[model samples]
Target: MTDEQQAVCEEVLAGPRSRLPAPLRAWLFRPELARRGQSLGAYARYGTCLAPHLSELAILVTARFWGSEYEWHAHKTEALKAGVPPAAIDAIEADAVPDLEDQQSRCVHDLVRELYASRTLSEESYRRGEAILGRDGMIDLVAIAGYYSFVAMTLNVFDIGVPEGAERPFGRGKARAEAL
Candidate 1:
């Protein structure tokens, strides 16, 4: 790796987590894009007004919806650690609606699910999201989807894989092929 590449890797490692993620490493091929992408990523995933649990849930849903295995595998643990209910994660893994107690979780799941399906938010969804999250939270929610979608695509294009022996959450299968 070039000195510049090493520098970028170090910068990412210096963040909250120590390990350099596969997606970020893949983005290293284009250092400028990676820097900007990681900056937006930090803000989108961490700077959002939504609770970590909610944001992590939304990210996992996005990963599953798009059948991005690397993304799913990356966030599943974080989502769980951030307090996303196990049942919710299980339901989303199987493409079922989770019986969540939190209104925000349900709202975020609804918003992201619809957004992935239609590439646009419906009026009812917008109103519901706005009511629950307000305008800023709603905007941040959508921004997370858009930004993570970019990240997911980068992973897919690069065929970034989980560490050896790790269980693949969104592996290629009939379900994965049909996701979409």
Candidate 2:
């Protein structure tokens, strides 16, 4: 691992809540905790919330878009446990088009694709998304993406290595060495 990655790994394992500079630690922890709290809050308000609503396929796509091995590694099991079809999970990891046969699954594919590709929704995409998810669901979808994007960035920036005994999220091929 690179020096930077090693440092990140140490910090993450140590706990971002504890490792943050003393002055900022409290605020950072509050917001981090609240983000999770609010996710739960939103779920409570809506009968079926966050993970179930967003679906594993969408989460996997977001993981791949950010090249976040950690997120992918973590979520792969969640996806499986949540009953996400294996084929869909495999397609997302491979960065291939999802073979969803239903409108709901297709909607997720479209939303994730548009968000990752442009970071902005086109009018048509927005309308279709709204039709399926309604306004609140749409907002939640964006939140999920935004929240996970932050996660992916943190993992990448810190070069947080995958836990031992975990399967490699990026498949069996080793990443090409960076040229100096």
Candidate 3:
């Protein structure tokens, strides 16, 4: 591990949990739901419902774009089990155009690309997304992305290392993988 990563790991482990000041603990190791004021149970329920409707390729693409190893690692297995094809996973990892065969998948791909590229949806992109996802669905999609982006930032800032025996979900280079 890099020096910074090693230091972060040490700090997280060494920091007093019960005895530390509440504000300090919040700053150093902010729990995801605490930051959002939502329970983990609620978030999981929302995620589970949305995951099936979203294109797996889009989710993978977003994870890669954000350089979120935690997001990528968690969702990679989930996507596969949810029936996302191996080729699509490879395409997402390689940053290549995915050959998604369905309309829902295509719409999601477009939405993810637009969201990442512009930080706002274009007229055409918004229209397409609205049509495919409907108003509430579109809102949910954006929320999901926002939620995961927050997670990505947390994982990076806290230097949450991948679990033992877990494949490095980010690309090969250490610097590039950690940049985000």
Candidate 4:
């Protein structure tokens, strides 16, 4: 690794992710992408108007949407730690609608689901999302989903997996729509 890239990696991963994540490690091959993604991910995750729990929920939805097992493995624990309900996590894993009660969580989930499923929100969904999340929160909600979708693509295309003996949370399967 170039000294500069190594430094960028260290600064971004100063916590439990002692090493670059597998997806980020792959990005080191393209150092600029890694650098920019590190900063963008930080903002999307920590600086977003969405709270930590809501951000994690968006990540979980993206992970499941792409069937990105490594993303799911990494973020499921984080989502739970950040207070995403276990039932919601499980429902996401099973490709079911999570019975979310918090209006923010519900709105975030519906926004992601509607966008991902239809590639555009219905007028009703768009208005509801705008009302529930406001302008900034709504934007952050989509940003988090878009960022994690890229992460999921990296993991899936690279065939990345969690470390050996670690359970794969999302499992290997076609997306729900694909199965029909």
Say which candidate scores most in TM-score.
1
Q: Over the stretch 89-171, how does candidate 2's per-residue lDDT look in tens digits?
A: 88888888867777777887789889989979999999998898888778777766766666666556555535656677775
Kindly report which residue pairs in candidate 2 clash with one another.
Answer: none
Tens digits of per-residue lDDT for model 1, 35-149? 7777788789778899999999899988888778878888999999999988989999998998889899899999999999898998998999999999999999989999989
Error of 3 at 57 (Å): 4.0
Q: Total clashes, candidate 4? A: 0
TM-score for each candidate, following the candidate numbering: 0.91, 0.68, 0.71, 0.88
lDDT of 3 by residue, 40-92 (tens): 21343234445563634555777788776766786788688877778888888
How many collisions per candidate? Answer: 0, 0, 0, 0
Select the stronger candidate by lDDT from 3 and 4: 4
Off-target runs (Cα >4 Å) in candidate 2 are 1-53, 171-180
Candidate 2: clashing residue pairs, number: 0
Candidate 1 versus truth, CA RMSD in Å, comes to 4.0
lDDT of 4 by residue, 1-180 (tens): 789788778877784345566677678778889888877787887788888899999999999899888888889999999999999999999999999989989998888988899988899988898898898888888889888888888888767776667887756643333210
Mind sharing the TM-score for model 4?
Answer: 0.88
Write the number of the candidate with greater TM-score, choosing between 1 and 2.
Answer: 1
Clashes of 1: 0
Stretches > 4 Å off in candidate 4: 14-19, 173-180
Each model's lDDT: 0.83, 0.64, 0.61, 0.83
